[model samples]
Structure formats: C-alpha cells, structure tokens
Target chain A: MREPAPRSYRAPSTALVPAVELRGLVKTYDEGELSVPVLRGIDLCIEPGEFVSLRGPSGSGKSTLLNILGCLDRPTAGRYVLGGTDVSALTREEQAWVRLHHIGFVFQSFHLLPDATAAENVVLPLFYAGVRRAERERRARELLERVGLAHRFDHVPSRLSGGERQRVAIARALACRPRLLLADEPTGALDSRTGASILELLLDLHRRERLTIVLVTHDPGVAEAASRRIFMRDGRIEDDARA
Target chain B: MAARVLRRHPGRTLLTVLGLAIGVGAFIAMVSFAEGARRSVVRQFETLGTNLLRVRPGSRARAEGVRPAMPLSDADVRLLRREATTLALVVPVARRTLAVTTEAGRVHRTRVDGTEPDYARIAGLRFAAGGMFDATDLGTSNRVCVLGVTVARALFGERDPLGERVRIGPALPARVVGVVAAQGRTTTGSDLDDFVLVPRTTFALFLGATEGYSSLEVRPRSAALFEAARHELTTLLRRSHGLGPAEPDDFTLWSPEDTIRAAEETSRILGALLAAIAAISLLVGGIGIMNIQLVSVSERTHEIGIRAAIGGSPAQILRQFLAEALLLALVGATAGVLLGVGSSWIVAHAMQWPPSVSWRVVALSAGFGTVVGVLFGYVPARRAARLDPIVALRRE
Candidate 1:
C-alpha cells in the first residue's frame, strides 16, 4: 500500500559507481543555539565489495558517521549518493526507501526484536521490501543457513547467545541483498572468542560473496580483519591505512 | 503484527478490553431495560379508556372532622346507574384475595372480582370459552363465576374449565361459567389475568352481607360529556351519603389514563438519567484505552526504532498500533453486546419487567464503542510514528 514496495538490488555487478559516496559531510546538533558539530567536512567513498573498518575513541564522530551512512540520520550539509542516486536531498520517505533497498545495518546490540524468532528477525528487511510471505520464509531460511544459524531459526534473541544473536542480525542485514552493509561494532557486546568468531563470520561473508561491508570498531584485532581501516579523532579522519 | 505486540502483555490487554466491555454493556442494558418498562406502561394504558374514571372511598381523616367516612355500597352502584343521565356505564368491582380449590385437589390463592355483566364490556374481557354471568345470574345471586386465564391454567392446566366447580373462600362452591383470554402483566408487575370474576349479588353469600364494592369503574357516554358526567355522579353520591353543603365529598374520583401518563413521563426522565450515566462510563473506558495505548507506545519505543530502522514508514507504524486498538475495542463491543443482552434478560425476569431487546440499541452501543476506539487510538499512534529513530535506537 505504500511507495510501490521497493525492488530488489542487483548486487552492483559491472557497475561503475561506488556503493556509498559522501562529500563534505557535516552534522551539527543545535541545543539552544549552541552548535555542536559531530561530523565536519567528512569525504569518503567505498567501492562495491570492499571491506572497510572505521575505528575511533568516544567523541570521535564515528557513530554519527555510521548513522549518516545507514540513512538513520541526515547530515546538516552534504551530498550523499547511494547506488548512484543523490539521497541527501531526498525527503524522509525517500531516505527510508534507500535504506530499505540499498543498505543493511547490524548494530552492536544486535537490535533483534525480542518478541520475534531468529527467522522472523532475518525476514524483516525482505518484508519491508514487499517480498511475498513464502519467499520471505524461504529467503530467511537461506540467509540463516548462510550465517551458520540454521539450528536457531525458531529461537528468539533472548534464547540465543550474544554471538548467535549477532549472526541472526547479519542474516537480517543481508535479507534484501543490499549493496552496502553497515555494522557498528557488530561484535562489541560479545566475549573475546565470540567477538572473534563474529568478526570471522563478517570477513567470511565478505570473501565468499564479495559483499561491501563497512564496520566500526575499536579493537585492533577487529581492525586487523579489514583490508582498509579509517581512524577518526575529534570529528575528523586522523588516519587511513590499508591492511 | 499489532496482535503480536498486544499479545506480549496479555493481562494488560485483557483488562483494557474488559473496561470497554463494562461500559458498553451497562449502556445497552440501561437503554433496553428502560424501553421495556416504557412498553409495559404503554400496554397497560392502551386497555384503559380516555373517558374512564375511578372512584374509591376517601381516607380516614375528614375535611370536616364531625362526619366519619361511611363505606360505599351496592346502593351507590344502583343509584349511580339509575340517577346519572350522562354516565354510560356504572360498574362496581368488589375484590378480595382468597384461596380457591379446584376439582383436581389443587389450590391456588388468587384475586376474586365481583361485578355486573356491564363490567365485561368496560374492562374489555373476551372469553376463550363459555360466556360471562348473565342478568338472571345477577338477579338470582347464582353461585356462578368466570375464571381468569392465569387462574384457569393454575387450577386445571390444558383442561376444559367451563363446567368445573371451584371452591371459593373455603367450601363456598361456584361453577366456572367462563374462562377469559390471556392478558399480560400490569404496569405494577401483577398479572392482569390472575383474577376470578363473579356476579355482585352472589358475592354477598360468601361474606354474609359484605357492604360495598372495593372500587367503581365509571365511563361517560362520550369524551365531550366526561367532565359533566363526573360532576353529576359526584353530586349524586354526595347527596346519597348525606354530606351537607359544608362537607367535602366522601370519595375520590380520578382518571386512570392521567395517572399512567404521569408515570410514563417519569420513565422518560429516568431514561435520560441512565443515558448520562452510560455516557460517563463510556468516557472512562475511552480514557483507559488511551492510557494503556500510551504506555504501550512508551514501552515499545525501542521496538519502534527497530521497525523504523528496518524501513517501516511513519504511516506503517501509525497503522499498526491504530489497527490493534480498533480491533481490541470491536472485540470488546461484541462481548459487551452478549453481556448486555444476557443480563437484561435476567434483570427483566428478576424485576418482572417486560423483556424487549431492540437490535437498534445494540448497533448504537457498538457504534459508540467504535467511535471511542478511534478517538483514543490516534494520539499514541501519532506519537509512536514521530519518534526519532537514532535516539530511539540509542535507548536501552
């Protein structure tokens, strides 16, 4: 009944443009006329299928950047082109459309609905994409299996451990097969071994499917897993390195 | 999806639904019961005459303390019938509650009315079988009586009661000359068909010269002469009772139609009061719905974030919660209708009021619930739809 239900993406095969393109991005929070800038003049681009890790301490504006990249928040001034469409100037509804069709997000908290089973969590994005119920279930099963969570399909988030919850989150993120995958500390809440396994899962997904992944984390061990890493300090990128 | 969300807190949801149900049920029951009472009053009044008047002996204390009130007698019936030119019919009714025995050895206590043959036409008595006591029975003081439909059923259910003999007032045997058609309950909740009728002359044999009739039913020939006929009868009765010019009349004359009309007005006022109370209860129910919905919205703020982050639009979020509230209220409305109808029947029987269930009243009650649902669901749904996704997701 709304927006003609977004269509599926084509994996950006033989595409010339980057999956995410941002130029001179600025995000300012206004509290009683006091302008607190979070992301100031950030310029970045990520090619399709690239695995990138963003890292910084608190107050480094990495979270704001991730939120802007995921289309959950808008930059105060910037031109953001996702899937070759200028989306920063788009309306809030159009932004939601882009988020549904082009971006998949995994959070540190896993952000799985407590009331839904693991398979239902995985089916969420495809449901918003207007995929039919039978196909949604089939794809949920396929993605859950791909994430090595085939056994926990019927289990809710509370029934599964932290690593298992993160895997379900990953399966959910890939439900629509979005061109851009954003993870903000995907393993930040798990134990060291579990966190390492979650990171290994993300890297394995990247290598197996050539899926574009942009993850934010602090552990050098996590940064070690990515091919490229960007570090931010005080609202600006301080370092960029290739692994 | 809304059902799934609501099912998460089953206790709260059920309580909310029950609140709405009570409101709707109470409203429908009040209206339906009032309508039943109104219909009963109307039925009672319909059989009474516009030109009809009732006359009974006045109270003990007199306007002039000198004269003690004398009892009315059969002489008054004869005098009113002979002397009054404007009056159409003068029928005296003698009533007594006594136990009567049937031939089958069954005994039931019922009211007995002693009156002349003209009382039949005045009271609209139609016989199911046989006929009323004739003028010969009245002149001879014959031991013949007519059984009301209720008394006949109680005395001899499904059996022909025309020739049966029933004992009146302990061993005073009277033949059942007729059985009247069924008449419904009165406005005062007594059955209209629970009386036995017999000739006035024969009634004197049981009580050994009982003085007068219990009450008199007077009818004027036409509506135009009703007041004049009442005045002439009052004058004749006063003169016969030896009340002088300075003394007040010894009996009271009033129109039964007027009394029933006043009672009908009172019922209308009571109906309005009930509607007010019902409105207040419905308002309370709506507020309860809003309160619960707002709590649900606040409690599910994180879920809203998850939904929004997963690409559910503001409209979709709004639709989800609004639909749930409406669906819950409709279910309550349905349950309330059953509760109302069930309780109304029980109350109608317990209070002996007529049972009149109107489906229009049911629709109005359920429609009111729908209005209540939509009115309360909008606020919290809008609040949920407008939540900031980033901040909402950040909340624990």
Candidate 2:
C-alpha cells in the first residue's frame, strides 16, 4: 500500500490555528417576504481535540449552528473558519468539497440509508473521497469494529436496532478520517440506557483518537459529558463554561 | 446503490420497462417488415434480369379530356430492331382478358398475353412441361397457346394439357402447346401464374387488324449496355414517329434499376411515417419513466440528505439516478428487440412472407430507447440533486 499524502488545506503551523473559529456568525431563513433570524451574532473558538457541546432548547438554534459548523449550510453573515480556512465565503460546491475532506456529520435520526448494509453505509464517504474499493471496504470494516458493531457489518439499517443504527452512522461519519466530527442530537431518539451507551462510545472514541467534537443537544446531562459546554437561548450564546 | 434503490420499487420499474419494451418492439417490427418488402422488390427485379427495359405509351391531357395514349405499332418494333445497334431482341406484347373453356366445358377467366417466341427468353420464363412455341408455330401463326401454371391447373386439372385444345372467348379454339413454370407473386403484388401466352398474329386476327401493341419489351446485349440501348431506342422511336424537337416523345422507358429505386424511395417514406408513429408510444413510455423517477426522488428525500451530508456531491446524486434510468432503458431495449423479432417471425410465417431483421434497425431502436431514457430522466435527477440538505433532513 502507498503512503497517504498530506492534506494541502492543513496549516503549516497547526498549533496557531484553532480547529474551529466563528466571528459574529448569523443565519436567517426567508419565507416569502418574511425574514426569520435563527442564529444571531455567535462568536466562539474551539481548540484542536476539544469536545464541545452546544446546549439549548428546541428553538434555541443549536441544530442550526451545528449545520453551519458541519458545512451543510452557510452562515448568512460573519466569518466562519474551519481548520484555518475561511469557509464562510466558499461556494456551495467548494463547501461540499471541504465537508468531504475535513468534516463528518451525524444527524438526530441516524439517517442511515435503509437499503444499504452497515459496512456499505460506512464506505459511502470514502467512495466520494475517491478511495479504491478494496481500501474503502477495509476502512469500513475497521471503523465498524471501532464502533463495536463488527459482527453487524452486513445488516442493513432496517434490520438494525436504534442504537445499532446510531453506531453505524457514527462509523460512517468517521470513514474519511475527518478533522472535525459534528453531531446534532445524535442520541435524541434512543432510550436512556442506549443513549448513555452511545455517549460513552463517543467519549471513548474522542479520547482515543484525539478527535475535535461539536455536539448539539437540549439535555444538560448530555452537555455535561463534553469537555466544554456553551448554553444558548433565543439564537445567542447565554453562558460558556469549561470542565 | 442505484440498482438497489430501483429494486426497492419493483412494480414501478417493471411497468416502466414494459412500456419502453412495447414501444421499441413496435418500432423494430415495422422497420423490419418494411425492409423485408424492399428486399423482396429488389430480389424480384434481380431475378427478372436488370438488363431488361419496358417501353409504354405516355398519356397527355387532350381537348376532349383524358384519352387512351397512342400505342406502339409493328412498324415501331421493326424500326427499333433495324436502327438500334445496342439492341439484343425486342418483343411486342398486347394483353386482353379472355374466358378460356376446356374441352370438358370448364371455363376460367384469365389474362392472355400476345408476343413472339423470344418473349420467353427475355422474360426469364421456365417450362414445367412442354416448351414454349417453336419457330414453326410462330412462322405459320398456328392457333397454339402457352398456359401459365394457374391457368393450366384451372383448365385441365390433373390431365396432360400439351395436346388439349381450349376455346378462346367467342373465337376459335386454340391448342395448348406448352405449360409455363410457376412464378409466384410479382413485386406489384400481382399473381404471375394467372396468364396465358399466344402468338401476336393469332391475337391480332381475333382483335382485328387495326389493334395496336400494348408495350414493347427489350433486352440489352449486356447489363453494362442497358442505358446506351435505352438511349438509342428512344432516339430511333422519336425520329421514326416523326416528332419535332419541341414535341414530347410519346413513350416511357422503364428498367429494373429505375423500378427498384422508385420502390425503395416509397418504402423509405412509408418506413419513416411508421417509425414516427411508433415514437409517440416511446415518448409516452419516457414520460412514464419520468413520473416514477420524480416519485422516487421525493420519497428518498431523507436519503438524499444523508448522502449530501456524508460528502456525496450533487453531480454524484444526479449520476446515480441517471444510471438507474439508463439501466432500465437498456434492459427494456434488449427485451424489446427480442419481442420484435419474435412477433415479426410469427407474422411472416402466418402470411407466408420472408422474415427480415436488420442490425441497423435494432441498433436504431436501442439507441432511440437510450436517448429517451436520458432525456426524460434529466428533470427528476436535477430535482434530486438540487435538494437542500438542511430542509431535506428536517422532513419527517
């Protein structure tokens, strides 16, 4: 096997550049002539390997902030930087490229492709990353093993349980070895026991891999598991604290 | 993945594929039949000999309205033989519908053609029994006739007809001296084995002296000399008839090449018209595919969101749907070709016509099906590709 090449987008001096930096980021939705603002003037910075949780109520825009951070949506105004790159001004195509190379996302509902097996789901991001078939399958197998679902590699999402599906989604999110992992209510639909286990898995993965994680959740118990927590109300950050 | 997604909706995929198959099948069947007809015409012409030419009287509108065109006379035939050096032989033919009665009183209405002994050679006539009229029979103007296979079967049944006499319509009975070989339907759909042949002198005696010849059949010495012989015959006939430079020659020249060209042109136009009609059904099938694809996109909106979030670009999403559509079309096209060839074979067998399927026609139908798939699949694919991941993920 050939050695993997270094990423061109990574900064020459990695210590000076934070994993994520946002300066007055704002998001608004336009419904006909009405303009409803979602995220209003958010300012934050996250160092590499920090596990940060965004805590808020249902309408507090925590999910919206996570979407922007995942590069799935653009901020209407203000600068957003990811790994020293100014992503706020990027086009939709360029943002997709950045997401493919640098960011991974796990959604509230798991969103596993119902028709695909767990391994196939994990291999999808690698497919877009232009990885060869053998390498993709190898990586998918390793990631499924990492998530403790190695035996469930061939089980499709429809056949898997809620917790198993969430594990598969987490495995898929890590397939490309992204710099940042973004989770929005990842355990929202699980029972407490299953949710707690999923959180433990995430914490273990974070510590072992030194992964930068930005998790959004409404439950304070879930937020407390992170190394840093930012509390939001009415689309603005109300409190910030570090463990 | 595209195949897996399509397999999720088996019923819709089958229905769409069936629609495309039917359209493509109809196209192939019609084109193959038309091609068969064209090949049949060319084959008939080839058997009759391409070096042969026919001269017919040209018609024109007169002050008294349309009238029968002036027919060729014995003098024109003589003049053509004398002046046209490229000529091999010329036979003047006159036709009349006559009721023939056997000695046993069996009567059959049939076409009777009057010509010389050389008519058999020029017309590629073969003998199934006794040969055509010999030189003595023509020289003496003997009241003898040659019966076509159909006429002989109708008049004589199983008995030998070589020496049997058949009475012409209100004329003296003529002896059957020969039986011509069986020739099937001509390119014009006429039965060739339904006529009788007799000497021109005997026919003229029955019709009276002033009756003119219907047409003249000429054979060139070689295939390469046909055009030259035709030109020479035209010039000779024009001068002999005393026509001025401005006066139109009152004759029409026809050859096998001209006949084949005209037949092919007509069939081409007819084939195009049929193909266009068949294409409507294909369009309808394409619309059916589009409708199903649109429904699939809407149904898989969340799946689209998940893919987008995981780094599948819009172009990749578009390609996935397009591949599904294309796979459906290709499968339909293959099945359609088989159905088309099979049905055409059945029809050809039932109708006793030769079955013909060309590779070009198959290629055209398959290519057309693929084009329809891509054309109709574009809108749905674009819609799926353009979906906003945020909104799509938020949907229930």
Candidate 3:
C-alpha cells in the first residue's frame, strides 16, 4: 500500500488580504496514553467580507476547526494566520487578546450572559477591548438598535424571545467592531421564520460593514445562502464550492 | 466601588464584619485588664514611697515556714545612727494587730504599726488631721496613737478623733494625736485601709517587750543612693551581726524599685497570656473569614467566570474577592474596637480599676484583622481566578 501525499494549502488571493487562514491545522486530545485527533491537517482560507459556511455532520472536526480559527484552542501542529498575525506563535494571553480584539463568536445556544441585560451582553467585547464605560455603552446601544433590539436593551437573556436573544448575541459579536464574525448554528434554537430573519440580519451585517463571516451549520439552506460553501467529512475538507 | 461591592452582598459583608469585631473586642478587653493590673502595682509602690527600702529578716539556712529577723537591739539602733551616712532617717518599726476600744464604745481590730515620729516621713504617710508624734513623744514612750483615715472614720462616728483616747490591749489609754491619710485598696484587694500607728517605745512598754524589730526601713536621700545605701547598711549589719561572707544573711531587703520591677515582669507575662488567648479567637475569626470566602467563591462562580471572560484579568478578580473579605473583617474589627473600649471604660469606672486604652492595641488588632482577611481569603480568591472562563460561562 502506498502512503498518500501531504495535502497542499492554497493561500487566498491577497487583493483584499484573507481574514483567516489555516495551514495543515491539527488538534489532538490525549486520553491517558491514547491520542485522539479531532482535526487533522485542515487547510482553509476565509477572505475579507466573504460569507463562508462550513457544513459537516456531527463529530467531523467542523467545530474544532472553528475553535482554532477563533483562537480558543491551539492546534497540536499547524500554522494559523488571522488578520496578518501568526496566531499559533502567540501566548495564551496574547491569543485571548487577538480573539478579544479581532474575532467575535456567536454560539448555537445563544450564550448571552443570563445575569446581564441585552445591552450589557453586547458590551462584553468592548469590555475585553478595554473601552471606557461611556464609549462602550454608546457602542452597545448602537449595535443593539442595529439588530432591531433597541427597545429590549434592558431585557435579560431569560426575558428575551429566542429570536431576540440570537439577535443580541449578534449585536454582542459586533461590539468591538471585530473584523471577522464566527456564528456556530446562529439560528439553531429559533423557529424557521426567526431563523431566516437572523440569517438575513447576518447577511446584511456582512455586506454593509464589510465583515468576514464564517457560519458553521449542517443545514443546506444556511450553507447555500453564503457566498462560499465548504463541505467537511471525517476531519477533512470534502469540497469547496464558491457562489 | 467598595461601597457598591459591600452593598451587593450585604449579608456576607455583615457576617464577616461581626467576626472581626468580636476578635478586636476580645483583644481590647484583655489588654485593658492587664493594663489596669500594671497601674495598680505602680500605685501601690508609689504609695509606699519611691526612695524607701524595707530590710526584713532571713535565715542562715533555708528554713521553710520560719520567721527570721536581725535583733534590733538598742545597740544595733545606736550603731545604725552612727555608721549610716546615706540614711536620711532610720526608724525601727514593728507591726502587730490589736483589739482596741474607742471612747464611743466601739471595739474593732486594727494593725498596730510601732514607729517614731520620722516613721511618717519614711513611709510616705501624712496626717489627714491633727499632728504626728515627735521625737519627744518617742523618748518618753508616749502612749500616743495616730488613727488611719479608715480607723478614725470607723471609731469616731464623724467626730474629731484627734486628742481622743483609745484603749489598746489591757485597756491602756493611747491618745490619738493624728489621723493617717487613707490609702485605697491595692491590686490584691488587701486591707491597707485601716491601721493605727504609735511610737516603737510605746509598743514595747505597753504591749510586749520586743527586743527584735520586724523590719528596718531605710530611706535614702536620693534615688541614686538607694543601692549604695542598701550595700552600706547590709555591710554594717553583717559586721554587727557577726555574719561571715560564706554564710547567707539573716535578713532580706525589699525596695520600691525591686517590687516595681517584679510587678512589671509578672504583668508582662500575664498580658502576654491574655493576648495569646485573644489571638486564638482572632485566629478562629480568620478561619471564619476563610470559610465564608470559600463559600462566596462557589456561590459566585458564574459571576467570576463572566467577569473573566469579559476581560477581567486574574489580578482584577483576585483584588475584587480580597476587597470583599477585607471589608468584612474591617467592619467586624471596627465594632469590636468600640465594644472593647467601651466595656473597658465601663469596668474601670465601675470597679475603679485604671482602664487604660492602648492605641497601639487597637492599631495592631485592626492591622491584624486586615492581614487575616488577606491571608485566609487568598486560597478561595485564587480558586476563583483559576476558573476556566468557558466552563464558567457554560455553567448555570
């Protein structure tokens, strides 16, 4: 049996410069002496202002890849460059700083702080950015209104509707004016109509603010709506289709 | 910010503050008692006179439960009069308790201090009324007695005790020419309040023939000469008593300085013991703070996680918890200080013990409370700081 050749990573065209690039990314976890690889040699590029959707079945390394791109986890072996910074070379605090300053995350479960109001949740990124209180509040209010939740600014996560909560999460991700927005099943918890509304809001933000978006979903409609779609299978990219 | 934090968790804050107050209050109370004792000892010594020394008896051998004294013969007295250079006055005195009757027909027990006119000067005693006995009174073995303030008040019924005749043992009439000033109770609560003074010659003639004195009291001219006077008098007595250098003297000498030093030393030991006990409570209070802080960390795990995720550094988280802990301890310490100081004052005023408030004690206890807060609160604060922001945020 002949061994397979190593996959080559293609760098995106540098016209606008890629917002996120991963070369030979690998992530492994150890259970005692056993090493379980979740992401194996993932090579991907997301260009500035491009809406990309990553589609895969459960346990196919899609979320793991997203985590690496968001600077939440270090790859076991690989190079990750985001916003012209070699993220793999940065220390933990530096990585957190990068994530805080440049990347915004939206979770499938709508992870807004339960104790804080919608506006307060939106101000979280600015808090990490060390923005002064007055400025943070101003920006938070503006983003809340942008998401059509201006009247629900004082509503806590528990009080907000599913769509309202997801909108707040989106507003929070844009708080520090991050360059890239990563939404993991942004409409997973909402009804169809609300899900379509959230999807439309994300598309509107991506086009208007020139923000790069990477949406992780198993839904075909969500993936098809993106400007580019990447399909993953068994910890490897199966296909890349551009719209 | 401090006020806001405190207000946010009022119950925990108040509980912590209470613990500190109890610790501080215990410290203040213990220290005050010890301070009062020290003052009492000083007062006793001061009343006995600063320049005076008491030379009492001892044995050639260590005899347990035995009374010993150098025989104060007339010749010994004459020898002291001639050889003593540092002695401003040397009065041979004796003490015996006697039953006496007054003209008012009251019989009471009293201390009979036998001494000459200069005895009053040496003992730091002053006449509250009338006049003390003179050398002429001692020479004639005058049956003149001086009533102490307590004795006079008890026997005379608010009447003038001066020139009144009092009957001692065998109904011998001793005229009270002077009233000795009242001396309050000492630390041991002893009865130095009621006593009577008379000439040594009178004591020997009327009561019993005493060839030996109980003690020889020496008063040096100045404090500087006290040691010299003691040394000189010891040498003179040793030579007169025919004691060799190899043998222990038959008498022991006591002075205000020695008594004062001993009192101070014992007081210090007692104070330390009390402080140690109080410190144990403080330690317990510290443990209480630690326990409460640990519970707080657990209760606010989600809050801590959120703060950290939102850009609160480990340092900031640590500081916030520590601040809350300190706030609790500080409140407790403040309350304790007030209670301790106030109780000390009340006890002092009520019992007439010198209630001395030591500022150093208050400052030390407050600082101690703060230190305890920081020390005990650190482990929990660190635990809170080390929480994974992701897990914390994910937690309900």
Identify the leading candidate in terms of lDDT. Answer: 2
lDDT of 1 at B1: 76
For model 1, name the residue pairs that clash. Answer: none
Task: Note the B-chain TM-score for every model.
Answer: 0.83, 0.87, 0.90
**What docking class should model 2 receive?**
acceptable
DockQ, every prediction = 0.52, 0.44, 0.13
TM-scores for chain A over all candidates? 0.94, 0.94, 0.92
The pairs that clash in candidate 2 are none
Using DockQ, give the best candidate's number. Answer: 1
**Docking class of predicted structure 1:** medium
A1-243 in candidate 2: lDDT tens per residue?
Answer: 121324667543276889999999999999999999999999999998899999878888888898889888889999898888799987766777778778888877898887789999998888877788999889988999999999999998999999999999999988877889998888899998999999998899799988899999877899999999999999999999999
For candidate 1, lDDT tens digit of each residue in A31-56?
89799999888888888888999999
Candidate number with the higher lDDT (2 or 3)? 2
Query: Which order, best to worst by TM-score?
Result: 2, 1, 3
Per-residue lDDT value at A194 in model 3: 94
User: What digit string (tens of lDDT, one per residue) describes model 3 on residues B1-396?
Assistant: 445656767787777777767787888888887887788788789879889878776664676644455576666667877988988877788878888898667988888888888888787777789878888888999889998888888888798888889998664689989997777887777777588888888888888865588778888878889889999888878887877787677777788888888988988999999989888888788888899889878877877765665445566677778877777777777888898898888877776777687999988987887788778888888888778766676676
Poorest 10 consecutive residues by lDDT, candidate 3 chain B? B60-69
Angstrom error of the Cα, residue A203, model 3: value is 4.5
Q: Which parts of model 3 are misplaced by more than 4 Å? A: A1-15, A108-172, A185-204, A217-231, A239-243, B1-36, B60-75, B99-108, B126-128, B140-144, B152-177, B180-182, B205-211, B240-246, B271-291, B325-357
